[model samples]
Target: MDDTEILSSSEQKMEDASTESPADAIAVTHSSDDSGDSDSDSEDEAESNHQIETLESELSANPYNYDAYVQYIKLLRKTANLEKLRQARKAMSAIFPLSPSLWLEWAKDEASLASSDNVPEIVKLYERGLSDYQVCSLVYWKQLLE
Candidate 1:
């Protein structure tokens, strides 16, 4: 199709040139992943999440910063990553005890996952929702009720 696509394909096949370009080539090589079709890459899922994790790690290493807390919560809400969400919930509950939204979202996500999986875990999730997130709207309550 496009000349750019042909060149990239040729380069990957080691037929374009023996020497590599310095700057954009490095970025492409690092980011393209094994799929070759960088546009459809899934590797960024971990890297994007790692950016949030790195922020939390940095925050843990430093003194308290409210802005960092906000960013952490934003990432927690944005990411579908259960492990990172768990860590963020724990950290938020410890550092910002008054933020009910963090706990509510965490409970909601748990209940959502439980419902999707249709596992026995939903019972525990319902109980957690009751205790930790009583302020969710009627829709969430109805979901948990079922």
Candidate 2:
């Protein structure tokens, strides 16, 4: 199969695994509330946690698993795990220095948390991103401007 086919197959497998029963996948405990919404929310959280674990395991086996890295970042961001999200972004940037998307996302996240003291750090992140992806697209330049 070609690369596209392989990628599609892999994505399909991931989707199937994600939709599997939370009990069979991850053991997430819910409160005493037997309400449907609470149960659904608990299951969703379990699924998200399961996905994060799976992606982290994939990254452990192959640090170059860019798709897994992106998914992991997105899950962390969704859960508002800022510290882990920051760490994941830093690690991804170190591994894929030329990835403009990762760099921009990281810079934007940092910018959102920026203060007078850490403005320099955010600027440094943008500088590093631009140094690697300067000629790739105008998006990076626009991101830097904003």
Candidate 3:
């Protein structure tokens, strides 16, 4: 067999071996669930907290680390830590005013809050986003209209 064919066949075998049958997977999951251990949940929370702290340290050392900010924001969102998410979003928006994606995400998050008090803030956010992206793309205008 050619080198490429040999590599592909081996890769396919690896993939097949890595995949478990649905029944087998469910059995394993059921066994774990039957253990009734809260330790894993606490461990996961601790790990998430550690990750947030590490990302905060990275951001502190390099405030312009946009990728770090994104990671931090994602972690906050995943944990439903709204307060931290808002702070992170505000900081990132201040640093990256021209980032259309950031603005859109922030605005959408605000919209999700569905608070009457947030209406004005959401409008302001959309306006700010439009200021940077309105002329660049029709999608921004469409979003504004919607």
Candidate 4:
């Protein structure tokens, strides 16, 4: 057989063999790569905490630092620090009427963690968002229904 034909035939045979008994061709892998990264995770947490502290100080110095509030909120969200996230959002809302999009994001985040106890709080947030804009937000309405 020509080289091309030979290679094609071998490949076909391998495919057929695998298809005949897929279980035999399956691999069971155990990776230890993630197990060694605990130290790195701690280091990252420390770095994020330092950044949060710095941002907090900036906000304290000038509560009108809009960018700092945004960054702080983003970092808190990334860390899934719910209490801190709530406080950050509250602080920002106090300083500026939160945009519809920000309200939507905050509502969604809270909804994801919502329980029966906090349903009223979520509805209040949606109502507040709807009131913030001169025009009604269809997205907010849709999410509120959901």
TM-score of each: 0.46, 0.67, 0.66, 0.73
Show the lowest summed lDDT stretch of 10 residues, model 4. 21-30
lDDT score, candidate 2: 0.70
Off by over 4 Å in 2: 1-36, 136-138
Residue 34 error for model 3, in Å? 14
Once fitted onto the true fold, the runs of candidate 1 whose alpha carbons sit more than 4 angstroms away are 1-50, 115-146
Of candidates 3 and 1, the better by lDDT: 3
Clashes of each: 0, 0, 0, 0
For residues 1-146, could you state the per-residue lDDT of candidate 1 as single tens digits? 68898677756744321222222333444555665556534554566668787887878886367677667665554444456556665665565543444444555556555545655565664555555555665755676575
* Predicted candidate 4 versus true structure: per-residue lDDT over 22-75, tens digit per residue: 122222101212445456547756898999999999999999998899889877
| Native-to-model Cα distance after best TM-score fit, residue 32 in candidate 3, in Å | 15
Better of 2 and 3 by TM-score: 2
The prediction achieving the highest TM-score against the true structure is 4
The model with the greatest lDDT is 4
The full ranking of all candidates by TM-score, starting with the best, is 4, 2, 3, 1
In candidate 4, how many Å is residue 131 off? 1.4
Root-mean-square deviation of each candidate, in angstroms?
Answer: 12.0, 10.7, 10.5, 14.2
Clashing pairs in 3: none
